[model samples]
Target: MYKNSIKILGAYGTKAKGFGTTSFMLNRHTVIDAGNLLDALAEDSLHIENIYLTHSHLDHISDIAYIIDNYFCKRSKTLNIIGLPQTIQALKEHFLNDIIWPDFSKIPLENSDVIAVKYSELYLNEEYHLDKQTTLTPVRTDHTVPSCGYIYKVNNAGVLITADTFSLENIINTVNNDMQIKSLVVECSFSSNMQTLAEVSKHLTPKLLFQALKKLKRDDITLYINHIKPSCLEEISTEIEAFRGNFKPIILKDGDFITF
Candidate 1:
């Protein structure tokens, strides 16, 4: 098995006093999303070289703004913000526009002519080599916007992170085809009682999550559950415990670490 560490910086669907929104770090240099990154990494946030975004949602991309602004003078190299073309477009037009935040992509860094931030567009189902041992591939996911999930491969082993997705067909297919996938990190945003809101928002409840897990062919893989809405945590936890499945799902929280 390929040995690589995935550190959970923030795993909740929404931010509360103790719970933070979704974000994770691959090894140390690469961050999966921007949510709560500044708070989680603190001064070590400067070490982040690349950020592979799962989508353009605020909860998933919120810390990108702060990272750039807070570390503006400290960073020497351009921070690579990567995601699907639509995700990058949304960030450019809506979030990082000059009206809301300074367009750091265009502005030069302090004491340097090079820009502080750069955006890289990734295509679905295509693998991009991060290094000799790491690669990232984007997969389509059902969400309110043009969103997608990420398959992060380290050496021969892989981990699937389904960021804020409702549909599971693509996720199941990805797992079924790739025997190297050792773990899955999926979102369950609400409890069974909020099925209507979950369906409307294109998120998953405990009931919906179990229904999707029935399609997964793997039985040995570690199943990690994330993105539980803070307000419904108790109900969602109870609902998840009530549902029986082949794999026991572990509710992920901030600072949780997974090695595969």
Candidate 2:
């Protein structure tokens, strides 16, 4: 029913008891990450055409295993899993190697001509057109492992999502230069007390995030914060509240919808 669209399937900073990890559905057909794709989506909605993964982190790619298994019978064609070269390599060598999980790429589909999964290579800063209206570009991010954020632009609505990152320079530069960037979704995973851990893990805490924001040149951008560790949510919120900045980041939970 959505024409020019927006939707959020899962938005918890991290999974709580009954909740799931970080996966966000765009237009109900495209996935930002596969963290909790199966758990968060209904059977009908799980018939996604493309899954754009930010990185190969467990929490980022967790539900990829389940979706392929449960929906194998229903998938009409090869499910396109797109990411950077390193991300695709990691998935092949580590996650879907048949040792950890069954390689869906090797499995045959009911009616399709070939395999169930396809690993597509994407380079950092390269923009690919998904359709006439939608485009996605990956921007490199600083993480413990190889990671990249995504810029999804549909017509005039632009969403800049930093899946898991600590580096602000690259993101700042991109956001500052792109006039189409209207909304930003960033992560803050720890409190000020855990700033050291956040740094070591290449994540952002409220303190570090503030310091990172100093690199950006704009204040009019709408900021939506995600990836807050459940345990330290309160402390991180308090710290971010005291952050004296022009760009106020609004915390988002699971199932929140954003419209441009």
Number of the top TM-score candidate = 1
- Estimate, for each residue in 1-260, the C-alpha lDDT of model 1 and write its tens digit: 12487889999988889888899898567889989888888999988878999888999989899998998888887889999899999999999999889888999889567798899998999988878998888999999998888888888898899999899899999899899999999999988888999999999998888988898888878999999888998999889998845568889989998777
Candidate 1, residue 17: Cα displacement in angstroms equals 1.4
Model 1 misses residue 89 by how many Å?
0.6
List model 2 lDDT by residue over 1-260, tens digit each. 35444566666556677656788777556888877776667685457878899888888888788888888877786788998889999999999999999988888888677788888988999988878988889999999888899888889578899988988788989999998898888899888888788889888888888888888787778888888888887888888898837767788777776655
**lDDT scores in order:** 0.88, 0.82
Give the per-residue Cα lDDT of candidate 1 at 255.
Answer: 91
Give every collision pair in model 2.
none
Error of 1 at 178 (Å): 1.0
How does candidate 2 fare on TM-score? 0.94
lDDT of 2 at 96: 96
- What's the lDDT of the predicted structure labeled candidate 2? 0.82
